[model samples]
Target chain A: MLLNQFLLLSALLFAMGVYGVLTRRNGVLVLMSVELILNAVNINLVAFGAFQDNVQGDVFAIFVIAVAAAEVGVGLAMVLLMYRNRRSIDFTEVDLMKG
Target chain B: MTSALLLAQVEFDVAQNIAFAIIAAIMLISAFKMVTTGNVVHAALYLVIVLAASAAIFILLGSDFVGATQVLVYIGAIIVLFLFGIMLTKAQLGDDDSVEKEQRSMGALVGLLLFVVMAFALIDTFGTQEIEFGNPEPIAYVAEPVDANDLPTPVREALNISANSGTVEISEAQFATLLPEVQRRVPGAEVRGNNAQIADAIFSQYIIPFEAVSVLLLAALIGAVVVARKE
Candidate 1:
């Protein structure tokens, strides 16, 4: 019962995150969606860790969190730099790199 | 007869199932809101809800340690970073009319299709099985009593055993027992003293990744400092 519930919720969250990543023009919202995806993955990790009676998955989840923190740090810095240059945070508008 | 036997073998607890259903519902709804909401700050707040729900699910799954870590690290630290990013970037506080509606509609369709496919895959994989929850076997080594002759007399005496009595050894089992009691008394009990197997695996096999995490943290600190540096 619990595993099914968790799996369903994780799928839903990941789907919502995909929608946000694809549809949202704002870079900040895209970052938030990325976090959503990461959270969904973490839920799956912890659930399976508990089910399989293994702590290694939980440990890996912790590593994922660390990597996520680093990713958000670098990603947000880049987003801020783009916002500074373009005066807009929308991805549609920040196509200066596109040839 | 086989179907009936299978049905009898599967035990579903109503209360737990209902509770999990509620938590799952809240998680999905909050996540949907987090993505769909037009306001950035509102989206962050909804993300907090989603994280909290995931943590709750973690606790329900019997990994209290990972669940608490999820709440503390993701909700407390990472979301704060996101909010800071929004502030630093000075994102428009209101919804913009210039966003492409047709693209968003297409993306929603794609997302919905992906959701259905993933859901079907999960159901196909796990639908026939029953999930049972209980205390897992401790990964630490379990100690068994050694022969009386193997232990020194004094050590045997301290364990309230006669020279003829089997040696009551203090091995991984003894440490495992003591560690949980200590954890109950002392908050944030480190797993170092209790589980030697875990320690060995972490220090020997995972050492590189551990150091890499530290390096990543260092990089993040420097990056944040550079980004936040005053012009």
Candidate 2:
């Protein structure tokens, strides 16, 4: 496969993720969008690792997965707290500091 | 090679490329649906497909270990976490109008702009580099003194060197440290397997970060318990 193919795919996926994050109102859905972005990054990392035939890329990709798992765990917990407090997960409502 | 007329080195496996195209198309469609779906449950379903397809892509890229982890961690655990979040938040199972903003054109515009910038940058920076894997051949000699018996049996017998000989052949790919001044670049041994290399890196150079991640996971675990508890 051409390096461009993988890179272009990753770029497109990342764009979709950005769109998801910008448009989604629910905190959990936005978190899902973040997962999309992370997965796109993993694709890029693995592709670069394959091109170089190096294991470092895969190592970091795995690390990204681990961190993402942790992120989701904490992120969802926060969402649960948001729902418990406000009876809603609407992200725009998170305005405790708003002037 | 500089001419825009000339294409990149077009070496690709026919079967693998076809597989890649098919899998990528599936992932793209599911991901698009995932982001656009109004129903939270439907979006979660779409995410499952996207995550599974991404795992396939990882395997296609020759990182089967990473692919397996993607399946196990992302789809198996993370997606479940997301669904639980949706359920607990009382997200409507039916299409919900409030899931999207009344004026969402900004996101579309930004996404388009980002894609264009990325396309231009990728094309400009890497126009002709082939996506080639390194050969697993041994291509270095340490030039350090070593007993002939220390060499692999095949190399030792093939070289027919005396036991007292100091120099030993080593593949630089196997031993990442290339003693530039003393090492002679030459094909002599085969590089180890891919998973072994990854395992070696994780345990050796990356040990600190590896342990740190474990600690982070533990912290996240405790933090989740503390934050999600009833107040």
Candidate 3:
């Protein structure tokens, strides 16, 4: 397959993720969008890795996945806190120190 | 055994492209629904589909190990975490329905701009470069297991394979010239990453970063437990 296809797909997916992050009111939904963005990055890395016949792309993809997992863990912990104290996952209402 | 560039041409693209099309369609739909679905659980399920499709793409590209890790980590662990978060949160999202709708148009506009720029750049810069990966077959034409130690010093060093690595890949033409007493061409699967090379890379060039990642994962694990602990 042409490299363009994969690149275009990642780009489109990334845009959707951007939209999700910007529009989602629910905090979990926003996090989900972030996952979309991360996955798009992964596709790009893997595609480029395959394209260049280098294993470094795969290595970076692995690292990105590891970091993303940690990020989601920490992110969800924060989300849990938000839900606990606020009783709502609507991030727009999270103005505890917005002064 | 007669060994003279044993060749069978395999048509590489037809079914592969079709499969890619079908899988990519499923992925795109799931990704769209994931971000747009109002129900949190439904959104998570959509994410599962999207992630699984991503795994399929990875496998299609011959990075099976990466694909498997994607399924296990993203779908298995991360989505489960999202589900747990959903179940724990009261998730009262209706109070600001109007606000969600209002912001969505602006989001759409920005998303469109990003897409346009990205797609244009991609299509223009990499118009038709085919993904070059995975040799058609491994070169093994030795009548017997060619011991890495037995090969002459120069050839051994040139092959750069240690005796213990077991799996050796060298072009029959190349190998014949270097160590001419070879027998048959071993024709089978392509010589791409099947986790072995990835392991090699991780342990060799990326050792420090791999160790650092493990430490980071540990930190995240402890931090998660501590933060979730009630005061």
Candidate 4:
């Protein structure tokens, strides 16, 4: 029962995250959506770990959290630099790489 | 009819269900807001609520370690990093009057489709199975009982008669008799087994991954510094 609930919730969260990533124009919001996707993955890991009577899933979740922290650290710094140079966080505005 | 009876029985344990339902609702609602809210700070705050609720759910699932780690790592560190990003990026503090409604509708459609597919998959895989989480059986080991003189016996008797028997026979009577002796030898080792066994596996067997995580953190720190450094 709990496992199903977890699966449902994780799926929902993941879907919302995907939509956010796909549609959002703000770079910071996109990063936040990525965080949501990472979190959904963590939930699935912990839920399956509990169901299987194994700690490996939990350990993997911890690793995911660590990776997420690192991602946010570098990602945010880049966003900051972009905003500083371009004076805007909108993805449409920063198309210097396109030309 | 039988399902109704089971539902009634579950109703008596409303405390557990209530917390689960509330947290699940909060998580879903905040996730929805995260995508819909144009204000970056508000979205980050909503994400914090989602993370905290998920952590609460982890605790309810008997994973205390994972729950605490989630709280510490996600809520404490990751959200703080997000806020720092918002601050450093000089995001407009006021209302974002520029979000395109057409994009939002398109995103909603995609999100809805993804949800339907995932829901179907979950139902296909786990819908028929019943969730069962009875209390775990206690671990038992044979050891010589200390005499009244506080002296340990040299030759330990194999109280585990099932192990000795070729047929692997163990009666309830034998288990009842052996239980006290097992408890004495392994003090505080109740029905849950050795919790420390997890720590042992992590430090001994999975030491490489643990060290690699530290290295990853170091690299991230350096990268953040490099990115943030003034030109």
Best by DockQ: 3
- Give lDDT tens digits, candidate 1, residues B57-84: 8777766766777888888998998899
lDDT of 4 by residue, B64-138 (tens): 777898899889888888888888777876666465778778888988899999999898888855345444555
- Give residue B1's lDDT in candidate 1 (0 to 100): 100
Q: lDDT tens string, model 2, B78-157?
A: 98999889888897677766734544688888988999999899989877676775544343344344556565554444
Better of 1 and 2 by TM-score: 2
lDDT of 2 by residue, A1-99 (tens): 788888888898999999999998889889999999999999999999998888888999999999999999999999999889889888888888999
Candidate 2: C-alpha RMSD to true structure equals 7.5
Q: Write the per-residue lDDT of candidate 3 for residues B54-129, one digit (tens) a residue.
A: 8999888878888999999998899999999888886753333545566889999999999999988888888899
For TM-score, candidate 1 versus 4, the one ahead is: 4
DockQ of 4: 0.62
- Top lDDT prediction, candidate number: 2
Deviation in Å, model 1, residue A75 alpha carbon = 1.2
Q: Can you write out model 1's per-residue Cα lDDT over A31-92, one digit (the tens) per residue?
A: 98998999888888877776676666667777888888888888888788778777878888
The C-alpha stretches of model 1 lying farther than 4 A from their native spots are B1-12, B136-201, B227-231
lDDT of 4 by residue, A3-96 (tens): 7888888999999999988777788889999999998998888788778877777778878888988899888888888888788888867666
DockQ winner between 1 and 4, please give it.
Answer: 4
Q: Which residue runs does candidate 3 get wrong by more than 4 Å?
A: A97-99, B1-11, B92-98, B136-193
Measured by TM-score, the strongest candidate is 3
lDDT of 2 at A57: 84
Candidate 4's C-alpha runs over 4 A off are B1-15, B137-197
